[model samples]
Target: MSFIIDDTDIPEDDVILFSILYSCVTVVFAMAVLSKFLTNEFRFGFRSALSLAVLFLGEPLCQFFVKGPIGVVCFAVGCLLVYSILPASHLPVGNKAVLITGCDSGFGNALVAKLDSIGMQVFAGCLDKDGPGAVSLRHSCSDRVHLLQLDVTKDEDIQAAVSIVQAHVGSEGLWGLVSNAGVCYIGELEMISEWITRKVMDINLFGAIKVTKSFLPLMRPAKGRIIIVSSVLGRISFEGYGIYGISKHGLIAYADTLRQEMRKWDIKVSLIEPTGYATENTSDSSMRLKREEIWDTMDEQTKATYGREYLDEIYNNLLGIFKMLPDDLTPVIRAMRSGLLSKRPRERYPCGAGADFVTYIFGLLPIWISDKVTMSMSAMPKTAKPRIQMIQ
Candidate 1:
């Protein structure tokens, strides 16, 4: 049937065409502006930029040019092309294998299930094989998912994992290695002791390196992908995220170098940065309690030097992340899969709501300006509480 129209009104075809054209142009323009920032943040080069442009604008572009019933057909075809252009690794599900660390909870746990569902052989490296998440994951997948006890920092655990993965893949070599284990605790430079500092670095920085190194040989022949899970804080650092920021900064640097070096070996490397997505104990209340715990550890003199109010302020600021972050981590999982499977994956994927803002805009900003802006939101957690009585 034809698109019949009243004499008083514009033709329906014209209206439809205008709407589709306007929508496509508007969305593409907005995404173009976003590209300026995302490109810097994630190093989203030409390929990624083009892929995303098509993915975001294809349907409207298709619908506008192809009329009526034909438009619907064209829209589907455009969407398929857009999806196909994006970096996505495709292999027989059960044929490929990936080992992911920190599979006990959060992104790691979620990704393990996602990969397993699609048919990949998943070696889920949980900190505790007997943990609730591991047990749950095991129950869900009887085969193709193996849960191994892993502590990224420990030598023995790494060796055992290498042995396990080698046994499964044989001459084929492992297809992917994901460094997803990390920890975060908030405190000032001096407030945290050398021991705590070392622990954080050992797990978040050194541990990932250890895992990657151990599995490199297996991946070499297989020409696999190394996926590093980093935080937005890797680029943007501030008060409460001091040590964690240091570790992430180091991690990103390490991953960047690895990506460049691995290129010659035909092995891919990608970094996935997510904003304040909920991890097992990363809730606002849990972090507040953690801050309280850290406060309790301070020596009396130290406590007196930095009052409880100061720590409270820091924790309160930390909670600001919860407001911006989404609980669901599907974007992160998709990124992981793309890096793992896609023949030409991105060097970095910044997923989640504020990931780009934190990495690109905030990271690129002048420190003084950022400091001023952040401080206005809440006073920098003071080294010492003001002595109001002295003023009186």
Candidate 2:
């Protein structure tokens, strides 16, 4: 068949197809960024739906009035171009080697799965050798998941991890480190033993430092990312979380300073502050056990002084609040992946609904007001003054 050049044969269907494809691509890009920033699924879903509805209704109207598909294409291209130029946390890299601590459960476990789904070679460090999380990760990811027994608080464990990575580097190398191992201690700071306080700091803050220091050499001049999994409590303190909050607060400072220190070597340091996650880490069983242990250890005199009823009420309320909070750990995994793979990763990523909201509100408040708010929220009943003995 002989084909004749015919400009009139260009169908309207082609234009429509092009417009739809362009619009969809633009929408995906927009949503990706929104997902990164907003993090709340309900809010993101609603806003996304609203925006698309407007675009669908408004685009046709514009096309009708403007008299061409050209107008729609032009507008779509313009918006897409603007989005392309805007800074986004999503990464382009694929198939990286990643190591994550505390992968026995919770956010670390979730993140390991997510990274594996994205085709990364994941090295999951768990506190338990035969834990359900380790078994699950191995089952889902098969050989792609490497399980290592690790306790971040222990120097020997840290060293062993370093050795493993070094051996792997001889063949395949790591791209990032996710410092997700940490413990929480709830109670009056004064009530907690000095040894327990030290242990909390050792695990939460020092452990991160040790792991980073040990593994950083593996990255060398090429540079790798370090993601510190902190909490919203890091930025703002709450009642009964005095020790836990203090440890995380120290982490914020540590991450910030480390970011600056690592800049010279092109190594990036990022922080993920997630709100309460629905995991055994924050479950009623764990919290109740800890509270009971603390209560049981108290001397009769100490119990009499504080009153058992008051302590019980305070601990119960704290755990209840944590249980009520919804968990969306996807944002934390997203942040971790972005930090590892993005060309320009953000210094800090706040995850979960409450965390993002609280962070924004905290930013808006004055320093004095914020301090007062924290103090008021964490207020406890005053202790009775020591009895004075009169000399006769």
TM-score of every candidate? 0.74, 0.75
Over 4 Å off, model 2: 1-95, 296-302, 371-392
The TM-score measured for candidate 1 stands at 0.74
**Pairs in clash, predicted candidate 2:** none
Q: How far is candidate 1 from the true structure (C-alpha RMSD, Å)?
A: 8.7
Candidate 2 residues 1-392, lDDT tens each? Answer: 52332334447786576567656755775676566447422234333454555456655544444334555665566556544433354454455678899999888899888888767777889998588888988888757778998999888887887788666655445678999988886877646666778888998999888888888877653477889989899988775688899999999999999999988888889999987777777788887887776677666556656666667766666676677766777767766777777767778878776566688799799988997887676535434332333434
How many residue pairs clash in all the candidates, one count each? Answer: 4, 0
Candidate that would win on lDDT: 1
lDDT of 1 at 53: 66
What lDDT tens digits, residue by residue, belong to model 1 across residues 342-365?
667888888876565556677677
Question: Residue 18 deviation, candidate 2, in Å?
Answer: 22
**Candidate 1: 10-residue stretch with minimal lDDT:** 383-392
